[model samples]
Target chain A: MKCQDVRIELLAYLNDELSSEDKVTIENHLSTCGFCAKEIVQLQKTERILKSGLESWAEVGEKVNLTEWLQEESRKLSNKEKKKEFTKGFAETKMLKHKWQKVIRFAAVALVLVMLMASYWPQLVKASTQMPWIGPLIKQLVLRDAGLSWAYEHGYMDGSLATVEQDGVKLTVLGVIADPTQTAVIYLVDGIEEDFSVYISKINGDGAASWTSPATKTSVGTIGIAQTYPLPEGEHTLTVILVEEDRDAGRRNERLSLELVTDRENISKLSISYDLDQEVTFDDISVKAKRVVYTPTQIMVEYTVIGGTGVGGAIPQEYASYLLTESGEKLYRVRSYGSHIADGVRELYEVFERPADVSNLKMVIPVQGKHQEINIEFSEPTTIGILDTDIRFAGWVHEGNMIEIEMHYEKYGRVKSITGWSVVDEGGNTEELTIWKGESFGAYENPGDFAWVTTKYELEETDRPVKLIATQVLTIVEGNWEIILPAIN
Target chain B: MTESEFMERLRPLEAYLYRMALAIVGKDDAQDVLQEALLSAFVARKQLRDPQYFRPWIKKIVARQCGKQLRNRGTVFPMGRGEEYVFDSTDKGKRPEDHLIWQVVNQLPEIYSQVVILRYLGDMSQKEIAEALGIPEGTVKSRLHKGIGKLREMLEAEKGGLANEMSGR
Candidate 1:
């Protein structure tokens, strides 16, 4: 067999799809020709890349809990069946009523009346609750809107109002509420004709602020804007800006800004902090719980782990902390954030949904042992580009329609963020891909002098070739800001 | 087959059906399609002539449902970004190359893409692919070979480009 014939049937031969005779012919030809042999090797490599890529893609793809989902669907189906049965029963009852109406017409009429009342009961209750006098009471009870009414009910609102009038428009700061998570300001705007816009110009303190909702046109002459921010607990001033633009004129008709000092005294006193120095020891590591903060919404626990033996060592999964109430109910940690290495100690913070009215709580950390470290080695190193920093691609793993490139860095703890990565085909049309996950330096097992990280991207199959490029890399900055929070009783 | 018998047969193939739906409509809509397909298969169970063909029969329903949804929404195929569909494991991560290959497969013609997904991701045999697609065995083989050839060509081009890039550097 010639090289051309061998190449044509190579994929089929590799896939074992060709007949035994054709396969034997290719094999006989490949034995004598080194070029055909090399071609077969390349073909096998390509097949591996494709198959492995698909396999990994399958692994990463979204998984559905089939049993649970099917059970829920089955329940819904059964409910539909029940509804049908109920309708059938109601029809039979109607037939029976028709037969009885000849003997007892008043009793049949009473039964129909009762059924009508039962059907409309929910609507009737809703109508009663929507009465003019009852609306405010219901709103207060439910804390429906995050506005002055809610703040007033939560005891975070102050009666003192600040008013600013400019350009025939009057803006009144109805109340202010401040807490650890957010500081909300409710303001009323008067003299706005039809359409208007409101913005929180600035919160003169640490953290960020934005308008929680658009200025709602509450009534004929009044509109309200509620702005909230995670403001640092201290005395600070807030600026509210109102702008009215005329589209036909293509210009602003009126603009006004008002500044007011936040009523710090009236803010809700909801959170309490305790200094803890508790320690728990396991086989491989020791965990110290340094501080615990309890708030109505969440409980924050700060801890440090030390003496885990290995490169890229992590706290064992079994050591995950949970709260145990006095009644022996366990509450799992809902979220954990801010894991950083400081002074050679792994510092971690976890947040859990606070159990109500639990004065004393036991934080349990069942330490199992150190997790086994898996070392990933890159056999092929591909050098692609030159930037100010030394970042190289070590190797990549393929799974269906996606590839994860192992990124190696020369310097540890320098690269902050990887952004703007995309695969550009030969046609110059770029198909943008995202880095789904990234690990900081020292978080992984680094065998060489440098650290390694892996990032995954979505790929498209094109007839033309493609190259990967990153638009930006943010470097770590060296500084920290501390904000003081007031103690609440 | 009765509805219960159909459901009993389909229960084990739910994962396969899910991946197939995901390939066609994407992760967000895959569940809806799977649900609709199962409900449809249950409702039309009596129409199934042979119980042995339940796998392909259900798969056909899922594919048609997925296509209908895509048309109704006027959405192009492969709508989600790479990050939207991720492996649940923290230990295993995807590479850029894997993503690239996935995209290439997705960008293939609908017929080719369906055959590739069914053969590989759905873990179906050639016969099953043919049955599910209502195509002859020879057509399935032809499409599979052509689809794979196109993929190999693209991959080879990409490798050549990378080599050039390395030399240029």
Candidate 2:
């Protein structure tokens, strides 16, 4: 046989499994072939060595305990049985604990329900007054048992009707007044004659005003007005005034007058309007109104409405107009609500005074719903203080919050100061500052025309000859301050 | 079987069973298989019908147990890899023949090692070896033949390494 053929059967040959004839033939070939004979000898020697080596390795496993594990498994099953019996005994205790837990949870939920009803009691009462029908249903379905508690808290109920005089007309409002924390809407009503004027204002103080005015032939009826004012913690006084006058039928007429007083607290006045002459006046009315107040906190402005000839009626053609001047510079036009004499006689008449400067504006409001022009003058400056005074720069003077420099200035030499400053890229990082109006230096109040003293500016800049500024450091009571560097400018 | 019965059956054949497990699972896991297989067999003794065939049955059980452990452990064969061959070169004074033979055997593949171990350690017949490993008798014969051939080749390579070393020195 060839060496390859013999090699393939060498294991069988070694195990003595080869047929006798084949074995004899292989032995004869091995004796003749030196390579095959040597190969066979080497293979036998290697196998013998490997076998002995592996046997020794296997002897190491002789000590392994295989049977002991079976007994342990059996013992575990019995232990599990024992645990079952023990667990059964604790079931009652667990149930008792669960019951107490449920009771505590129910108590907590009930308390939360009670607290929520108590908190919203005032709002619920107010809502009930307005929507009397749904109030009971809402409380029943929602508050459930807590409804009685809410009712007990708001047992007393009272309401009143008040008037606020605007220009010369009296506007009346009827409702339960709201406090500083609550808000309420008051509807206007004509109280005296048809087409009379009404004035509404948020009350600032408590006072009384006489409700007497002579009615003119061209004047309309009067309406109730309500004003909202702040009350610190107690009773306060509020005053109301009345005014009666005739329409300015393309000519100046006797002016209407009203007086109001408040001795108690601060009140915000919200509404003011005059009764429009419907018969002899125009129908179409349009008003162009804008928000003029531009402080970061709030924006306020006053606008006037100008109107045209009344629609086909004995109400002579009367044109209505209003003017809003800032720093003596007028800005924005006033007009009625619609355009046409047949529409209605209603003017966009509201005044606003924000901390910012406003000038060179005039708008047309139609008294008779039709065409009208709002006159505006833009040349006059409107800021009251120096344009650069109220500005504040932080990193402009120091490296971090450890040091801050507040610069304040006022307008000078007949120039209106448009004061505004922003923290722009402090140390290459943009920062924002919230402007404040406190008793701090350069604080403005009742910002007004060029002749007036206070105003807000779009940015801090100067063109005035006599600019003035006041500055102070804001120190935190518990924080440390370091002098990084003095402000450069 | 009861705990006492299990111990009685295990004590006599423990050595053989351990060796078989070592052959299959390597030294680290051989003992683990022994304990696990014994516990399982003890719990399920009623299923073992032939008492006289205990040794063969236990061997089969140990093999199956080792396979299961490997499978459970996500045992990948690490393709084309086998047990490392450790040659004892410390005995420099021994006849070079002994060292060369040792090196050759060490170089054998794991499958060849199993065959070598069964032949020498267990002293089982060819048919018994085939039955324990669940392979055909012919397959076992072929494995033995190939294993022997590889050993001879490794021995020749070892001689070459020694000669080169001596010449370099």
Candidate 1's displacement at residue B161, Å, is 23
Clashes of each: 28, 112
TM, every model: 0.34, 0.27
lDDT of 2 by residue, B32-113 (tens): 5666666566666777676776666666666667655443442322111122111101111233444344334544676775
Tell me the interface RMSD of every candidate, in Å.
15.2, 45.1
- Report the C-alpha lDDT of model 2 over A80-194, residue by residue, as the tens digit: 6566653336542222111000001225455455334423312322333432332232232212112122322343112233334434333433233332221122322223331
Write down the RMSD of candidate 2 (Cα, Å).
Answer: 43.6
Candidates 1 onward: DockQ, in order:
0.11, 0.07
